[model samples]
Target: MNPGVADAALEGGSAPVGPRRGRLGRPSWPLTILMIAASLTVLVPLYFTIVMAFKSPAQIGSGSGLEFPSPIVWDNFARAWEMVGFGRSLMVTALITVFSVAGAIVVCSMVAYAIARNWHRRAYKVAYIYLLSGLFVPFTVLILPLIKLTAMLGIDGPVGVTLIHIVGGIAFNSLLYIAFLRSIPLELEESARIDGATTWQVFWRVIFPLLGPMNATVGIFAFLGAWNDFLLPQMMIANPELQTLPVVQQLFQGEFNTEYNLAFASYLMAMVPTLIAFVFAQKWVMSGVMRGAIK
Candidate 1:
């Protein structure tokens, strides 16, 4: 054989190249620009929110909105806090978020586990498809019926709101959970069963613990959804005193007047918890998504 051919054969068919196949390609400028633009859509509003939140009523009208507050007034937050009944509304929102997150994780995980394990069975398969079907239906289409039903059931309050959040999240959360569950080996459960563990024990001990990443992803989503929900709490919680933070924040805006500074202050406050949740859980969420996609 020729020396060149021999060298090529020994070098896995290609001995030299301009760029190695394993090396990453150059960054796509257009994609990078698009992503930056998309991110600015979020960051710009946030910037304005922080600016408006700190601006005094005088500073707000005196100059462009991009200008920072000269004195850095903290009174907007205080005034918004008082006007919106921030303490009570915060408590109500927190409770609803906590319950909604917990319920979504537990219920959706269990349902996903059952469907995934018994996918060959007709009943479970039908139920799985039915649950997924909910994803196609818009929430607004059901709001009127939901309102009437909750009223009839005498749960048209925070309790009803929390319940609806949990139920509404079932479809999407279960899809994530089921996809992640597929990546888990059935051998683990079988081993647990061989050690005298019942199906329930096998799940709670062997399976549930392994679902930490996906749980974080689902929990964060549920927390954000429940916390940021405005329409449901606004329409359902009949008593003004029992309304959620988003609903109570409406006090800063009306037909004839709007307190931009105070409204932004309240908006900033309401979004802080969600920001914290996402910041902490983002890693787990990415890992869960990657793992689920692998299967």
Candidate 2:
């Protein structure tokens, strides 16, 4: 055999074989396409809303829903702000959301910590079951009774709403906290206890501080729920002056008529705060969720 041919044969024989291909080896073009389509489907309404929000009533009425504003109307936001009572409602919503989230975090975290630490005890296990039982009960089921109770207590405004949110949120938030707490090493807590720290001191100084991601996750969820909630506020609060953003924005629509551009503008305005919140807390939210899932 020729030397060149022998060398070529040897090189070919020694060449690596690639890993065998299976279904997963092929690119999922169909799934990718479907996801893109789904994304666009969800985004189209948002795009249209943003466009309409920037448009004047005349422009919105005359132009295609999908079309961008010809001349962006900055006054739409100002007008929508006034129409929606954005100043007062924003304050109300912010107050309710802040208090509700803070209260839920403090109360739920404490409850979950207690349950997690005493999980082996029959009494604590029963308490955990009782707390978690709230998850199975729908808010709708208690609406009428809740409204009556709130009215009877004379706390039918933002205060009542905030209280309701804090209470209603405890179940899910406790669940997340419990899961995350289980992932925490017992030694850290034991060490703190050994150092003459009381249970509350150890929790606040050590365990609570370590719950940053979970706290952010819980806060985001609580804020979203409190901020976007309309039913509880609507049923409990009849005074237009005391209504939250969602409730007040509903007043912009009539049974037979609607202000399309103004409504979109109000909605756009209402969305800004929550969107900003999500943008800031998205990292923590993702991290917390992954950790919770892993635990």
Candidate 3:
């Protein structure tokens, strides 16, 4: 091909890929502006939350929530902690989150492993499809039915809420595990079986170890979902003393009145654990997503 023709052809071929960039290889201004605007939607609220949490009641009333407090007040956190019974709620939330994450990982991984290995069979294929159907069902639609079912089972408390979280996550978590499991070669399990390993032994000794990245990814998601959940705990937990932190934080709100400082402080506190978990495990999440996507 002629050099000039080749250059023109290459440029023309790539032209439809995306919007054109501006001078100096910068992205188009419209795209940059749109991204900035989208980012502000999150950043602005985060800024307000931090500022409001530190502000005194008088300061909160004197200005819009944008300004930093002249003298930051630690009392809001102290009051929010006491009013919400933060210690008890935190312990309950942690127990539910830990149980939910562990249960989801073990149960979903086993189910996905079974389904993935037997995918060519009719029964497993049907079972996989049946589970995947759950992804489309909205939680709101199940709430009323779940309320009745839990009451009947005598689990209308934190235990019921924990069970719901684990069960609810099976569809999505199994999907991730199944996808990642596809990328793992059957030779590994075969080698284990050749060493006189049983089916359960093969899975435990060979397959489960290899799912570390996907497990981290799933566990992080499960932790966040269980820890931050409010609706399920509020509706399902019969005893008011057993509510999770997110549900307990409702103390700061009233029909006609709100405690901005206390509410923001409580929210900030609840958000910290999630932020820490994501920060530490973010790389595993990315790697797991890429591995899952590959097969």
Candidate 4:
């Protein structure tokens, strides 16, 4: 055949295959498609919630359920805030979250440091087991006991709720921290000790900074728990004034006058602090989790 005829034949025919053609070896169009489908499956609910949050009552009320709002109502947030007393609730929740998380981090860190480094005896082990027992004992089982205990202790308001969180959270939080602490190089602490650093100084200056990522990881989780905690606050605090954001946000939907649009907005509002905390702590948080997992 002529060169031009051969070239034309090659062009008309398919290009020669470069590699093996099995599902594992070949370009996996099916697998890629499956992964994309799975991702959308997971993200669709988040997408739906975000879109619904931005929609108007008229749009939600229309029963389309999936369509965008005509007006794109932004004032639903303000209405939600007022109807729910969201500001006051947020303040109370923030106070509780900040204090509880800080307290948990401090107390848990100290306990973890002791258990991780200094001592590992039956006494410490038994005490740790007693703390960890909280994880097995469901909060539902303890509700009555806790009610009576709180009444006896005169710890019945937001303060009571914070204390409850600290108690409830201690076991898991301290375990994670202590597990991570075991991974820290003893040489660092030893060198600090040689330099005449006191126990508190060594903890505050050296070990503490090294634990930054883990601390942030623990803190964001603790904070979000406290910020979004509904049951403890609702059960412990009878005064409407003491209600948290989650409990207060519930006010938007009553036996009557169920404000779905405002309810969605309030839900979004409740997410704001957690969102912010994640944004700021993402790097360290992820690193800490990976480090802990490795250890």
Best by TM-score: 2
The TM-scores of all predictions, comma-separated, are: 0.80, 0.82, 0.81, 0.78
Tens-place lDDT per residue, model 3, 133-199, is 9999999999999999999999999999999999898998999899779879999888888889999
Q: By descending TM-score, how would the candidates be arranged?
A: 2, 3, 1, 4
Best by lDDT: 3
lDDT, candidates in the order shown: 0.84, 0.82, 0.85, 0.78
Clashing pairs in 1: none
RMSD of 4: 13.0
Error of 2 at 158 (Å): 0.9
lDDT of 4: 0.78
| TM-score, prediction 4 | 0.78
Once fitted onto the true fold, the runs of candidate 2 whose alpha carbons sit more than 4 angstroms away are: 1-34, 255-258, 289-295
* lDDT ranking from best candidate downward: 3, 1, 2, 4
**lDDT, candidate 4, residue 204?**
92
Clashing pairs in 3: none
User: Could you give me the TM-score of model 2 versus the true structure?
Assistant: 0.82
RMSD of each: 8.8, 11.8, 7.3, 13.0
lDDT of 2 at 48: 88
Residue 87 local lDDT, model 2? 96
Task: Write down the worst ten-residue block by lDDT for model 1.
Answer: 10-19
Give one digit per residue, the lDDT tens place, for model 4 in 186-220: 99988999999999999999888888767866786
- The pairs that clash in candidate 2 are none
Off by over 4 Å in 1: 1-42, 256-258, 279-281, 285-295
